[model samples]
Target: QFDQTIDYWGGRPHDDAWRAAAEQRIAELRTAPLTIRVNGALGAPVPGATVRVEQVRHHFRFGTAAPAGRFVGTDADSERFRAEVARLYNTVTFENDLKWHDVNPAEQQRIDAAIDWLDEHEITLRGHVLVWNFEVMPPRVRDLDAEAMRAAVHQRVTDQVGLYRDRLYLWDVVNEAVTNTEIWDRIGWDQFPEVFRLARAAGPNIGLAYNEYNMLNDREGHWRRSLENARRLIDAGAPITTFGEQAHQGVPLVPLPRVLELLDEAAKLGLRIEITEFDLGGVDDEEVHAQYVADFMTACFSHPSVDAFILWGFWEGSHWRAGENAAMFRRDWSKKPAQDAWEDLVLNQWWTRAAGETDGAGEFTQPVFYGRHRVTVEHDGQTVQAIVERTPDSPDWVMVSLP
Candidate 1:
């Protein structure tokens, strides 16, 4: 109801009388700031001149999910883990808090602390797995008959999702259920869409996602059921916003061409394709891991459909999967080859920084990433500075002159 009422994209124009009156009032008061013209030059000092303003940092969020239990500590024996996380990722997903069995008293403390850190940093949050029966289930709910389980599902959705209502931008409405009958086995496959519907109702504008693994290597029948399941949920009026594939690879990591092919197919769904749980493991050689990470991340980011590439966890100490091959970071907090590869792409290659001659009218334009930037204009050996905000809605040019 709220989204419909406050439709930002296609909402009706402002009331004509209100707009006319506002324009009239604005015209009556001419207090708008005028441009400061520097006398160094009559026009752009450089021929074919244009001022260049490029967003060096991407607004696109790079994120990861981790266990909250790793965050609680104040002694010499314990380290400030969340502080380390604050240095890298811009978004976070609680690895355990959103699950049913893990929402106990002890876990709640950790969950609260994680939320505080996220809020303090103003980081985006994705709530994972509202009703994932395969991963972990409350024992009581698991053993119940169909009717009791049905009630339990709805109740849990309401309880947990409702707790973070209007806060989480996305939620894994039903996880890995498309691959099996865990959820539909109890609720009936015909009513499987109910989980998504309940989640949409529980979390209003939150993105209800259908997250599953093996969607990429679906040369077999791996993706058939999941694809059809997504169709069913969409047709049934479930406000599914994003589709996720847990990209965890071992010995046989997904081929780059195959992953790109899957990305094309996922784009057909008309939703954001999130590589939610991405990890390239099962290789002892860090160089191999680094190359694989480079290829995998390049494929995902290059594709137009893919939105985010969130690693499962960064450090081996906090990683749920155990192995030298697993996770992006080593035990001593040193960057692995894989981490270096990813950082190089995001920070060096993708980072937009450019120097160019300003065009006539003392303006420069370039399509760069969306973020904050500082534009410096040089004319006649004097420099003038102005802040440039590159955003999606308004990303074009920055104007500057000598003061």
Candidate 2:
């Protein structure tokens, strides 16, 4: 057994017989420790060997939703929201926190606190919405004509992005613009380019997303229209980075196959996919809901284009849907069946941990997620600390020095 297992072969050649012997010798490394010496020319394997691999940052993003301040609560509620959100999720979208209709100084204060905490902890934040219609739209804008409305929209986009430009992880540049709402009809559906354009101008590096619901049910080709809208934004030169599927798959949802099929459609738009607002409401069966969450999340993770998945609300105490407790956490801050199910998958099953000691020719290799990893190598009384980043775009065989 040894440390600093990099390349000991140092470009040595071997014949078929030698290769066979090396394969047999390496196979034994899986069960026990081994050591070997390199000829520096023949590349001969003398005996025992092992390889270790680690991931630094994974490509997948698993997250959940929360409301404003324990709903912006005082003590217990605030602490629960703060601690639990950090415990489980890596990304979050304010349930109704940062919307335009409910913007207030106090609410903004609560929001500032949340974003600050997330930033300090290196968590991701998603802006719920930027451009919307129907009641949520400002009352002052109703009377504005097409040109004025466009100007108002631009101003709104510019102002919001400017305010949170540094802390924004992703922006819902436009939300549900495919509705039959007359306000959108007045301003021109094609104006999303302007809305998306403003967001990019203010926060050039922020991820801009077009988020919409009902894409799971297809709902009269609204999903198709949503994709078309995304493309239109791109055509108009808006930096649209993700297609958000608000996977509100109804109370008693359809089979997982159909759910995956719907997710696949959004993925085809050539943009990254995010299951932005997910909630298993309507049906109250906890057992079924837990299974649905696990299955649904698995489907989303299986897709190559899908990267971020978020639940709308995960606690009965603060769920947006009144009286309906379609949450993964109980009101008393206890873990529900669904919570355990999702956690079991994201934090346990797919989580990687492996160890191996190197042969005389130093080399350790293992399959791990693409991310930054803290690597520790030890032998005898010596210890080595290394920061290794395993990225999909990066090649294998990282060299770590040991003292």
Candidate 3:
């Protein structure tokens, strides 16, 4: 069994049994082979992304051919993009802001293009947002009467959510809605509720998220108001499955205590929570940036309610705040120190992996004892390790193991 230590940080030392199981799991992991699986149901794979399995390297290539466009003009060949995406990201989120613009220059075509590209690459698509108060107002709606404006908003929500319901798994039902408290108060809280209702009506099984920013400031009133809004929504019967706190402000300003408080409060609502838009910034010290990310992720995953974390944009070049250098990867696609920290703490250190002798059918089955383990494999004098984590609720890691 692994030795256990009880520290003030809420982690207990591993007991003997736990240690023994971990050692056995580690040994098994050291001998396992590797395989990568792509699931079209999960959405599009981001191109030019790199994934590491301990010391082994895997590159994700998107299969979609490059279109004759400004953006695609400089991109890699279609087949190469496909292979690279397949090797890198397990999932991809469709860039949909342009589709929400009032006079979207390429509206239908752009949406179709993204969908087609993802389909060809067998990538899953996530409809970024349904209602972003600052971004979606058409000139006509802006000039319309209050009632008409509300109707327009409702229609927009219904149309977008309904149209993509079958293809997208999740939607930022209302992005940054709470930030404009005055607008919501004046328009009636029902305006937001209606958006949620319309989205659910359009797509029953689709996951809905309420995404926002500055949630980790540690300001008492801010935290209280955020939680109160969530409670109010749940009380009003909105089909809100997730609460997304946008961590865009970057490290130094985001108080750890406040993040924990937000998680704890949100968990009470019985909804899954996500740090949907995370970007670490400002601090040039990579180590500090990484530690902050590690600590933040540890707190987030440690919470029972958080299901997953989606970085706003993984690379600096594509980040909304690209000029500020707020992403895990630099513009050149080289990972920053924060990236390593995240990989180590969240992906490797917190995950568990194991390998076992294959049966006559070249299949191996082993029960991964609870908690995180690193599985390794030694082939032809070289060793590789894969990280896996055990959650308190599920025992199934088979699907995760293949990737």
The lDDT per prediction is 0.68, 0.68, 0.56
Off by over 4 Å in 2: 1-58, 71-74, 101-104, 218-220, 235-237
Sorted on TM-score, best first, the list reads: 2, 1, 3
The sequence of per-residue lDDT tens digits that candidate 2 reaches over residues 349-368 is 55555667655565554555
Residue-level lDDT of model 1, residues 1-403, one tens digit each, is 1122333223333222323433333232211211222234444334333344444335566788877665566743236457666666677787876777746677777778867767777677888877777447877678888888888888878787888875677888888875557867877776667877787677777777889887875444777777777788778877788889888766555556666678878788888888888886667667767876777677777666666778888887778775746787777777788888887877666555666764454445454555555566666567776766565555354446564
Candidate 3 residue-wise lDDT, 368-392, digit = tens: 3244344543323444455554434
List the candidates ranked by lDDT, beginning with the highest: 2, 1, 3
The model with the greatest lDDT is: 2
TM-score of predicted structure 1: 0.79
lDDT value, candidate 2, whole model: 0.68
Collision count of model 2: 18
The TM-score obtained by model 2 is 0.81
Clashes of 1: 8
Select the stronger candidate by TM-score from 1 and 2.
2
Error of 3 at 401 (Å): 19
